[model samples]
Target: MIEDRELQLLINDIFEYYGYDFSGYSRASFKRRVDRLYQMDGFSSFPEFLSRVRVDEAYFSRMIEEITVNVTEMFRDPAFYAVLRNEIIPVLATKPFIRIWHAGCSTGEEVYSMAILLKEANLLHKSLIYATDINTNVLDTAKSGVFPLRMMKTYSENYVAAGGREDFSNYYIANYGIAKFSSELSERMVFSQHNLVSDRSFNEFDIILCRNVLIYFDKDLQDRALHLFDDSLATLGYLALGTKETIKFSKMQEQYEQLRKEKIWKKIR
Candidate 1:
């Protein structure tokens, strides 16, 4: 395991050299990720691992891919999607155009899911979903709109639970253990690399979803991300987070109103 001091050193070095700040991430989670990489790479010592990380750009990229959490799947938290369909989409439909930002959108399963929702509501032609992640590797996968064929069963179940009525298989074409989603869905999505820790808010959005991501950040970073979302979200627009994440105790809590038992919040201020 990497020592506490050594983990801090790694965080400092990464920020100084790569301009990627992991300083505000949860210490335990960050340390565990680094240690996993350190062991998997068979580094004999901390200095050796640190030395390689410093000298090799490709290795640094590899380290980043391993360290940043990218675990996500389609229609995660079916109930949340149900709420979006039942309560949120109807209101958003009143607008001329809808823009949504998916921060830390790992592999973009939810973004695609959102596209399906808008399509069902007949709002896809006027809606654009911006999906951003820190890892370029995951961004590429998200852009492809391809996923393992085996995962479709669960995703389809999630879709139904989220109030989807159409045949889920119609959304994708299966080929040799891979399911490629329709171009219609991918056309409305824009995937790019974005670091929520250091990046500025680029556009106003009707909805911003950064689910299951803030749990990895320290309070300072979590607050920072929430503020960015607050700035990016249009007044009265909604911000959605993971079940365990919230803006309730943050400075922005007063500026937002939670949507019942779900994690969605509307920016009232």
Candidate 2:
């Protein structure tokens, strides 16, 4: 087991060297990931592992990728997308233009999901999506908009369940074992690197979908991120979170009213 001092030094080294802040993440999760890295790399001692990472930048990048949660899929948790389509998009439709922030959007599946939803609703032409993640590797994958073709079967089911109007296959072309999404979907999106832990919110958005990303953060960091989201949303803007996440216990709960029990809230004040 890595000592607390060693863990602190390792976290500090990662931040100072890579500019990615894991210091605010949950200690238990952070420690578990670090231990997994140590075991995977065959390092018996944390100090020795740190010594190697200090000199091997490629290893450091891989460690960061391992430590960061990147699991996501198109229309994941179909019920949530159902609620968004049924309960939320109508509210957004009243607006002349809309800006959406897909915070921690790993590999852009959720970003494309939003675009498809907007397109089906005839709102895509007026919408702009800003997809951000701290991991550059995932961001590059997102920009390409290519996904394994095997996953499209599940995504097609999700699309149908989420009230898709057109054929699910209309959105992408199958090439070999990969599916490349339509360029029209990505033309309205801007992919960039943004760290939620240390970076301030860049623009006010009509809706913010930061799902499944905050469960790894401690309460203090969660509150900090919530405050940033609060500051970055327009009045009555929507805030969507992971199915397991809620703002009810946070300092800003009263400032937002629950639109659905499934983690969608609207700014009330």
Count of clashes, each model? 0, 0
In model 2, which regions exceed 4 Å deviation? none
User: How does each model score on TM-score?
Assistant: 0.98, 0.96
Please give me the total number of clashing residue pairs in predicted model 1: 0
Identify the leading candidate in terms of lDDT: 1
- Cα lDDT of candidate 1 equals 0.94
- Candidate with maximal TM-score: 1
The global C-alpha lDDT for each of the candidates, from Candidate 1 onward, is 0.94, 0.91
Worst 10 residues of 2 by lDDT: 253-262
lDDT of 2 at 80: 88
Report the Cα lDDT for residue 217, model 2: 93
Candidate 1 structure quality by residue, lDDT tens digits, 1-269:
88999999998999988999999999999999999999999999999999999999999989989999988888889999999999999999999999999999988899999999999999999999999999998899999999999999999999998889999999999999999999999899999999999999999999999999999999999999998999999999999999999888898888888899999999998
TM-score of 2: 0.96
Runs in model 1 with CA error above 4 Å? none
